[model samples]
Target: MSLLNEYRIRLAQEQDLRAALEMKLQAWREAYSSFRDEGFFAHHESQLDQQLAWWERGLAGGAQFWIAETGDGKIVGLAGGTPTIEEDQDTGVDIELGVLYVLKEYYGTGLAAHLMDTVLSRRDALLWVLEGNARAINFYTKHGFVPDGTSEELVGSWAGLREQRMVRKHG
Candidate 1:
């Protein structure tokens, strides 16, 4: 059997937010450990309650989230998309691929693509990715996204990192 068969992807429910967020945290730790220190992760962890509450509100406000989980129900990946909130965007696409994350162990297992399809099946969309995240950038590129020459420097705890906007325009 294929390895992808061992996992399932489905729309995330209210109760699934915490696990999805936790999985995302693990993914961030694994993916960005080379650029960030333990303090960054700890600071993020300390805001867990606020993050959970924000996700709860987003779900209640109609944000869509999809999660990949094992047969035993442990969340391993998550993806979410919503209407673009950037007033300055001239990409001509309103759908934004907000988040896509999978545990490092699941890399190259096609789980990320599945999650991407769940949230954005061939639609014209846009997303902002961290400048140094080559893995994510390459994946997005393979899926038809390209940088639109727009970029921004993140503020607060994520200060220092730059993000570039990518857009996939469907003909």
Candidate 2:
């Protein structure tokens, strides 16, 4: 059977935090190795524990985190969004797609799209993607998001990386 057909998506809980973090790490290692500088991983490694805790707290706080799981029970992808209003009044977008990552093994199987649709559910939203992440840019574009001309340089743990904002509007 096709890998795409062998998986399902559902809301993520506190119990799924560690596996979701692993999937995020694996996806980042595989996908961003070329897009990010050589020191990216080394700089970010020390903060992964904090990120994991943040994910757990976000879940507890009612952020909509979702995971894609294989029939055999392995979690392969995750996506989440948060309600946004005050900070993005400039764009008028009310939601932010904060995280979307999938294991490299599922890159071509449409799992990322499925995970996104599960969490965002076609809502009009905004997201920041790494400036040079062509694969992600293309994917978001395919889903109707367009660049909104905002960019920022990440500092500290993700120093040297840049990001641009993309937005999709309600139809």
The candidate that wins on TM-score is: 1
Can you write out model 1's per-residue Cα lDDT over 11-91, one digit (the tens) per residue? 899999888898899999999997789999999988888999999998899877999999999999999898888663678
Worst 10 residues of 2 by lDDT: 37-46
- Badly placed stretches (over 4 Å) of model 1 are none
Report clash pairs, candidate 2: none
Clashing residue pair totals per candidate (backbone < 3 A): 0, 0
User: Deviation in angstroms for 145 in model 1?
Assistant: 0.7
Residue 55 of candidate 1: its Cα lDDT? 95
> Which 10-residue window in model 1 sums to the lowest lDDT?
85-94
Q: How do all models score by TM-score?
A: 0.96, 0.90
